[model samples]
Target: MTRTVLVTGGSSGIGRAIAERFAADQAEVFITGRTPDTVERTAKELGVHGVACDAGDPGQVTALTARLDGLDVLVNAAGGLSQATSDDGSNLDALLAQWHAHLEQNLLTAVLTTASVQDRLTSGSSVISIGSIGAERRGGSYGAAKAALGAWNASLSAELAPKGVTCNVISAGFIDGTNFFHGQLSNERRRTLVEETHNKRSGTVDDIAQTAHFLASPGARHITGQTLHVNGGAFTTR
Candidate 1:
């Protein structure tokens, strides 16, 4: 039987790749983004349903999930680094803004979206959140939020495991493509990131996409409440 999948922030980058992976497998896929044009454009390109939504906003998340009947897979891929700024002239306020933005984008997006859609997840459903290697390193505020994501996933997995629904977090690192770096990475920085990895290479969007596909597959039914690192061994967890 065909499964239904939902991916947030699916207009481009890693999220789009995950949506495409599911669609290629004959799954009924729906994706959401904050912008109408971008979401519609991507849906047209991929032949999947797209909804305009800011997943961090409870109201938008509610409306987005209300459009779903039920889902076999839910991929919470919405997140980003906020701009560092002192635009408000208060240095402390600017710092707080950045931290709050990271928490909302990286952690709360997954939490709120999951809560909104829990009733729609059928048995054997899988909920996957996109985390970051930053959580283990010098990502600062963003890192803290991703770390909280792992903690939340642990709890969510425990709550859902008995129901045959699994929850996992894929903590990615040094991805080459996508707007993650916003085209501002220097060549030296790129080399440094790659060299930090055991594989001596940066990650691609497909790496995360394929992982999501498997986590939602029957093969991964026994795996939940875990953060599977996908950074080419950049950061190892015992």
Candidate 2:
């Protein structure tokens, strides 16, 4: 059976990898990005549908959801460290702006997108949100937002589980081949990140992509309201 999948922020990075993974399985995949050209290009390249949308915006999310009939998998992969800016250049204003951006991008994007598509999620469906290891330590505002994502997922899973829908967060660590650092990652930082991992290697987008695929599989139907860490043992839970 061909599953209908929607992946936000799928033009590149982990989202694109997940979309490609599903597309390979012959799933009907729809990918969204904030930019039209990128989304269209990636959709064409991947042989999937594409829509330009800012997932954080309620109206845009509503419009995006309208294009869907019933969804089998929804990957909320839209999130990143937002640059902080303020007109007055005041430290407090900058701080507030930074926090707001983090929450809006990393947290609210998932919340809004999921809520808008809640009714369309079929029974036995999955909601997979991309998270970060920064949520556990040294994650500042960005981490806090991801942490909030996990918390929200817990509640969301509880609510959706009774309806046969599973929701979970994938807390990823130092993945390579993505513009995650916006070209600001130094060699020293890169080495340190790999060294901190038990595997002694940076994660690949396929790592997270595989995990997302599994979570949406029949085997993972029992798994819900969980935070699955894909950081190569960078962080652990008992």
Candidate 3:
């Protein structure tokens, strides 16, 4: 059976890798990005449907959901460090702007998107939200938002589990070859990240991609409402 899968922020990085993984399995994949050209180019290259959308916007999310005809998998991979700025020139204003951006991009994006498409998700459906290791450490506003994502997923899973739908968060760490750092990652930082990992290597997008694929698979149906850490021992949990 061909599964209908949607991945937000799929133009590049982790989202794109997840989309490609699904596409390789012959799933009917749909990808979205904030930029039309990037979305189009990725869609063309991956041979999947593409939509330009700011997932954080309610109107845009509604519009995006209208294009879907019942979804099997929804991956909320549309989050990162916010680039929002405040022109008010005050510390409080700047702080508020930064926090808002983080919440909008990382937390609200998943919340709104999932709610808008809730009706489309049915039995055997899976909702996977991308998370961060910072949620357990000094993530500041970004971490707080990700931590909120996990909390929301817990509640979401409980609500949806009775309907045979599963929701979970994939808390990733130090993935290479992504714009998560916006080209600001220095060699020292990179080496330190690797050294902190038990495997002594930076994570690849495929690591998270494979995890997403599995969570949407039958084997993972029994595993819902859980935050699965994929940081290669950068953080541990009992």
Worst 10 residues of 3 by lDDT: 82-91
lDDT, candidate 1, 1-238, per-residue tens = 9899999999899999999999999899999999999999999999999999999999999988889888899999999887776334468888888888989999999999999999998779999999999999987888999999999999999999998899999999999779987778999999999999998999999999999999999999999999999999889988
lDDT of each: 0.93, 0.95, 0.95
- TM agreement with the true structure for every prediction: 0.97, 0.97, 0.97
Ranked by lDDT, top first: 3, 2, 1
What global local distance difference test value does model 2 have? Answer: 0.95
Instruction: Put down candidate 3 lDDT per residue, 28-145, tens digits, no spaces.
Output: 9999999999999999999999999999999999999999999999999999987666324468878888899999999999999999999999999999999999999989888999
lDDT of 2 by residue, 140-234 (tens): 88899999999999999999999999999999999998998889899999999999999899999999999999999999999999999999988
Question: Which 10-residue span in candidate 2 carries the lowest summed lDDT?
Answer: 81-90
In model 1, the Cα lDDT at residue 4 comes to 91
